[model samples]
Target: MTEQLPDTISRLYADPGEYVDSDHPAVEAFARAAVPSDASARDKARRLYTAVRDGIRYNPYVSMRSPESYRASSVLAAGNGYCVGKAALYAAACRVHGIPARVGFADVRNHLTTEKLRQSMGSDLFTWHGFTEVFVDGAWRKATPTFNDTLCAKLGVKPLDFDGHADALLHPFDGEGRAYMQYVNDHGSYHDVPAKFLMREMAREYANMQGEDLAGRDMEREATEQ
Candidate 1:
């Protein structure tokens, strides 16, 4: 059976929460412009995803958080943070617009770019970042708007775009088959993503564990010397 989103997700859109209804500015302006009664799910989902993607960035500073002070408009206002920040903005907008959305991640074997960069020194970097997953007509589609042009240019990649309907012409990675970031965990069944605020605690947990294991081996060697 296909996955179906809860009906409450729709209710939330009509009866927005404190943040969505308030004139806090961050989300107020964005919510007004983005949501349209006649727009299809794909149109709203794509616009929400792209709005965040084209607005925010993929910084390492912002904490892995659900929408707090930041919402759809936050990307337009503060305009910082990385994947996590972008994902939060995207999700908040989707929820506000009655589009059921969730966070996701992929273990990228290689982050390909139009050209190689100096910062990409080592091999197999696991930046288990955050993105948004929206339930369309039948299937759920993945989107990452956080890596906008500025960040992509710095990282030597292209900006992925998503117009209000179809995916925009700016998707960075090739998502068809080759450049796929593997999805092993079915939403924390095996892996964890911090965005969900549940089942998955953090996206970096697995990567952090690997580093600890290496440290343990080095410690053992030093103990032998002592």
Candidate 2:
């Protein structure tokens, strides 16, 4: 299929049907959260980000790799989730304000250390990890704020700000660290590395991340710790 804007945006903004504007109190509060009258696109994106990063902490009480029945209100009430829930909450909030945002993912190395596993476990690092992308200026930029201290400390990599226009700091590993190439709907064709579709594939493929947390998963944990 040829790349078309409306069709592409339609798929990109497809509702998860899990959360909506009035389903929960938290969602309502977030909807009411101030969107400054003078805000620009970046300001709007940042506001949505602050809501999740500061409002919620990262905890996997819900199905870690799968989304629960979290409406924006439920997430606000609970104030926590792994990645998907928080990202869903953020995306929902941004959408309500008429901002164009969608979920995205990457395999960040050294993401966390689990209690049952002290060593590098591959699949645990890539499960349903979600981030948001907002339309700005003439293009879309990425943002990741759901990852918090616990997960960052466990993985030993610095979590970054969701500016909606900066490169991801949670690199798999390099001098300054590098990013996992996005991998969704890949047909072994010429790829652009950051297409939004990769988020879907990333959520599905690495859902069972377990064991050695392969070099592909988080080589930094292995090289730095050992």
Candidate 3:
């Protein structure tokens, strides 16, 4: 039997913040469009998961220097973002509809990276890979909406799907059944994205890869530059 969650636990997941701005118009609109007013909690969770998974383009090269980039409303307005930004948007969207959600982070080794991005990062190790942990059906289910369907098609990887009752995590193997991403370190979960903590780790881990001047560097350019 599923254990009952206390009110405090639910509140923790629904709490809003600078990063998880559930009250923002953008987030509210996002939630409403994804989830129908008459839908059940499970159906709402599923729709929201799919909306976030495919709606926003996944570009791992967004700037981490600005705090605005990490905000859920900002990510929604931009229409594209990295894993962390997308995760924040998903969590915020969930919270806006009174569904409990939180952000989760871990370091991963991506085995299938584009040539440009792989070279730019100088390593396969990706720090602070983000996903959403949504409380649904008396439990928390994880989903990674980092890779959009278009990108998945391009990369030949199967798109991740969420059903609300199951964990929608990254596939251990790709479409060809080859090894994909591997999680190395889990930084646990939070109600909001910890920008300073994440940025510090990114700056430290990707300093050389990001170039000498991380503050002024445009990460998108680095990912695109041959």
Candidate 4:
């Protein structure tokens, strides 16, 4: 039986925010094409999770200076984005199908990162790492679709998958038992991408990240080289 969603929860699927523009034509079409319309909520969420996860190449080198970088439709059109943008895309896609979803943020110490990226940020601690909180089966399940399967394979870590029932967070250890990602703190969830606030926090945290156009840099190639 489908559980009754409260007004607050229902509102999550309503208006299309500046970033999470679910009502956009392209986003709606993408969501509809990802799964059959008659699929269960869990099935829909699961399909959407994988669609955004692998469909969008995870590229951390992209510039965060523009507000358009964080917008879901723009991210989808670009074919690549960082964690936050991918999360926003997933949330927007889910909302297109009436699945209540929100973007969640956290600070993680990533052990398996490119040396160039680490130097660029001056630290391995990634702030505002984004994931999606999907409401399924009367509970909010966390899904981290940031690292695609191909990248995880190259990094020697298991690909994060969503079962639509459990939280799909990053693994703390790699296949060889080496330390991987350590979640330091969580910044809670939001209905839409807090673009300005995230950019401000990112600028404050990563001194070298602001206003830099890092296009054409292949993060996957860097990972393979490392």
Candidate 5:
């Protein structure tokens, strides 16, 4: 049985934020279409998780300076985004179904990144790696819909899955048994995208990202080359 949410955490189901615009028409429609109206909370969460995970492609080559880059609706319309945008979209979709959800951030060392991406970021340590946290079955469960199936196939990594009951974090090793991702630091969870703080920290950490035009670059192509 699903447990009741406390007063403090109930606000997570309140109106959407600037980034996680769950009230947007597209997000609402997408969420509704992903699951049946009679579906239970866990079923809805599982369906929405997979819909966002595979429906939208994961593309790391995007301009971080643009606000639209982080907006959930924009990410859905564009059909691609990095971890942050994808997480925002997943949270937004969950909210549309009256599910309490939030975005979580962590610093992870990606040991299996492509060379061009490694050079672009200047390090394999990715800060603000985003994931979705949904309150289901009486607990806040983490769900990472970052790496899509196609990209994971190209990179020889298994796609992350969400069971709506357990945390779906990144794997510690790839298919070849090589080290893949390691969580170094956690930034906790937020009801909305902390855009200003996130951009400020990102600017301070990644000097090359400022004014960098990452257009036309394809992460899938790079993964295939590796």
Candidate 6:
């Protein structure tokens, strides 16, 4: 899409749907708690990125059971989510604070995924991996709030960072110098998460990991065992 006017972009970023619900009380409260009134948009975006990155525990064993699980407020209230849920929360929180934000997806290979998960998913390629693109300083910057600090440490991979300027993409190597991740395909950005598209992709790509849904699957245990 072409560059949108600031007001138009802001409107596009705000949503009241199953995913990226900025109007929800929990998401509003979270945005309020993560950033102060005096903070600049860049500062607020950084704080929100950090808050979502670390605050929400990442788990993939659970199912996407219903539309509610995709809501930013719902994910915030639950205190844990996978990459999609975490990114949704970050985008929602940004919109709640009047920061233009959108969700972007990519097919990633060899992320800090565990052997069990890799086998369960039948491949190392994870489709629809989510991230936030915050509009700030006259340009949109990408940030991946997945893989919290502890998880990064456990996986021996450097934690990703975003300064509200450069893109905080996945690292190309682990701590031991092994190739860590690569973005196989970019699905572009969207004001709202394409939930049906994501679900269908998950169903096709993660059939072995599915269990009625894909929300709370325990990934920490697998990570720890590695």
Leading candidate by lDDT? 5
Scanning candidate 1 in windows of ten residues, the lowest lDDT window is 211-220
lDDT of each: 0.49, 0.51, 0.82, 0.89, 0.90, 0.81
Q: Judged by lDDT against the true structure, how good is candidate 3?
A: 0.82
The regions of model 6 sitting more than 4 angstroms off are 1-6, 15-17, 211-217
Q: 1 or 5, which is superior by lDDT?
A: 5
lDDT of 6 by residue, 95-163 (tens): 887888888999999755888778777888878888889988777889999888888877877778888
Model 1 ranges off by over 4 Å: 1-25, 35-37, 63-77, 112-124, 153-156, 163-226
Stretches > 4 Å off in candidate 2: 1-16, 20-25, 64-71, 106-124, 149-159, 167-226
> What lDDT score goes with residue 169 in model 5?
93
Cα lDDT, model 3, residue 186: 92
The 10-residue segment with the lowest total lDDT in model 6: 209-218
Per-residue lDDT tens digits of candidate 3, residues 1-226? 4756799988878878789999898789889988779998888888887898789888666777667778888888888888999899889988987889999998888987777677678898888899999888888888998888877877778789888888887888888988888889998999889998777778787776555433434333443442
Q: What is the lDDT of residue 221 in candidate 3?
A: 46
lDDT of 5 by residue, 92-210 (tens): 99999888999999999999989999998999999999999999888888999999899999999889888888889999999999999999999999989888777778888788867
| Model 1, C-alpha of 59: deviation from truth (Å) | 1.6
Residue 199 local lDDT, model 1: 17
Q: Which stretches of candidate 3 lie over 4 Å from their true place?
A: 212-226
**lDDT by residue (tens digit), candidate 4, 47-104:** 9999999999999987777787799999999999999999999999999988888899
C-alpha lDDT (0 to 100) for residue 90 of candidate 6: 94
How well does each candidate superpose onto the true structure, as a TM-score?
0.57, 0.60, 0.91, 0.94, 0.95, 0.91
Q: Would you list the rank order by TM-score, best first?
A: 5, 4, 3, 6, 2, 1
Q: Clash pairs of candidate 1? A: 53-145, 58-82, 59-82, 160-170, 160-171, 161-168, 161-170, 162-168
Winner of 4 and 6 under lDDT:
4
